[model samples]
Target: MKSSYLRASAALACAVVLTACGGDDGQLLLSGTISGVTKPGMILTNNGGSDFEVPVPANGTGLTRFIFPNRISSDDKYDVRVKSTPTNVQECKLFQNTGRAGFDVTTIEIVCTFKTQALGGTVSNLKNDLILVNGSDRVIVPAGATAFTMARVAQDAPYGVSILANPAGQSCTVANGVGTMGPADVNNVTVTCAP
Candidate 1:
């Protein structure tokens, strides 16, 4: 009886050890590559849990590994995203938003760019000349003009245009004239004037 009890105890201990070491359940390693970031660190969140401020790779073009504080279950849903981006840089976007932890994931990639486009619009019912201001830059739309354009505006740049003065006794206002620039040119800005 004593020998049998000792054997049972040994088997139980082995099972406990294996369970503690993630036996039968495969380990999940999460990693990915990032580009267009030259900062020291960025925040990454897993499954919407607490934010993990991981250090950005010094090379600015390499894989970034993330080690979860606790062991995550296999086949669990993982939604990794950029909690915050580096300052003074183009926004970074994630390609794959959702993934399953069936195996180690390493194909995720992040890309960033600083390209921008122009913003312009048409002027309707203009009985007088007026000036359109976007920041320090201004464009003068003469009477009987149909359109105006602001070139080389930065992406995601906010523009608000107002009529400096309308000499044609026309009250002028902006319509669809307030917004941030997107990836494409903004040509729908409308400045309508009424005499």
Candidate 2:
């Protein structure tokens, strides 16, 4: 009994000291910084392993950093990348997130930016300064102008370009002005300000 107790204690000591033990040995932490990660639904992966869903702050959200729950073995290769992003997020890119795990992994940064696209089209006829509006955004078209472009709209957002004011003695109507902005610019809107 005494000999077995000594052996068990020695094994326990070795495990605690992490010398030749199997539990929690030769592991390294993985973490990094984040910015512009609004909304949610952002998934990250390490060496194509388990998924790491980024947390979104509710009030006064400052989700600027993350520490992955899973740890990688030291000297093992770690390839961290963004698997997906929220609908509003245009793109989420990872920097300095791929390398061999060491005693101290370098700082990784994931930055995300929103999506936006230009909104504009063409106008015809001899018209005075005309006013146009898309939601809250408005544009003034001078007389004899061939083309016009309103303020940029958020990608996939609704846009309704209408004639706010027409030139004197002339009526104008816009066609194909009500729709959702897609991935590319909208240049098909036609404004006809004439008799």
Candidate 3:
């Protein structure tokens, strides 16, 4: 009787362990920003490929993002498209050309250029931009501003903040008096001037 009870307990323990590791419903965490000179409200579409659409975030800075709960698939490739309401040329160009999704973050960084605004102006530009870097260990210089911003949706996860320099592909200077992520805990930022 004692032997049978011990075997049953061991089996139950094994079953619990397997159950914890056997769920295929794992979630894929998607986080990134999209910017352009287009209107404040632009809709980013997955175009029936997958279930995702990130509208351009308000704040008139052209920064937008979304998080999808579905698991990412390696076998499938999505034809993601960004659709503007009336269609702005700059926004279309920025999203259509720079927009992409993948499992690798480094490749994403290499292929993507962060969006920035025109120097000394309140306009959106994507031509000359830089990848927004989380400056925890290294100092990231902005094209214009003294400090940049870092935004996050998840708790305690390492959030990556970004910005694009001159959207025209010109090396411009960042505006002064701008603030960046402070210390190791700043989760969101908003800059009045370009960087």
Q: Which candidate is the best by TM-score?
A: 2
TM-score to true structure, per model = 0.43, 0.60, 0.30
Residue-wise C-alpha lDDT for candidate 1, range 93-169, written one tens digit per residue: 78765778777776667665545777888988887778888878778888888999865676555677666676467
lDDT scores of the candidates, listed in order:
0.71, 0.81, 0.38
| TM-score ranking, best first | 2, 1, 3
Q: Which candidate leads in lDDT?
A: 2
Candidate numbers sorted by lDDT from highest down = 2, 1, 3
Off by over 4 Å in 1: 1-113
Q: Give the TM-score of candidate 2.
A: 0.60
Q: Which stretches of candidate 2 lie over 4 Å from their true place?
A: 18-20, 25-43, 47-80, 83-90, 93-109
Tens-place lDDT per residue, model 3, 1-195, is: 999999998788766665454433233333445544223334444435443445444575544454444544332243445554323322244332233344521111101223322211121232333444343422234444434343322221233433444333454333332343222344224333333
* Residue 172 Cα positional deviation in candidate 1, in Å, after optimal superposition: 0.6
Candidate 2: lDDT over CA atoms?
A: 0.81
Clashing residue pairs for model 1 = none
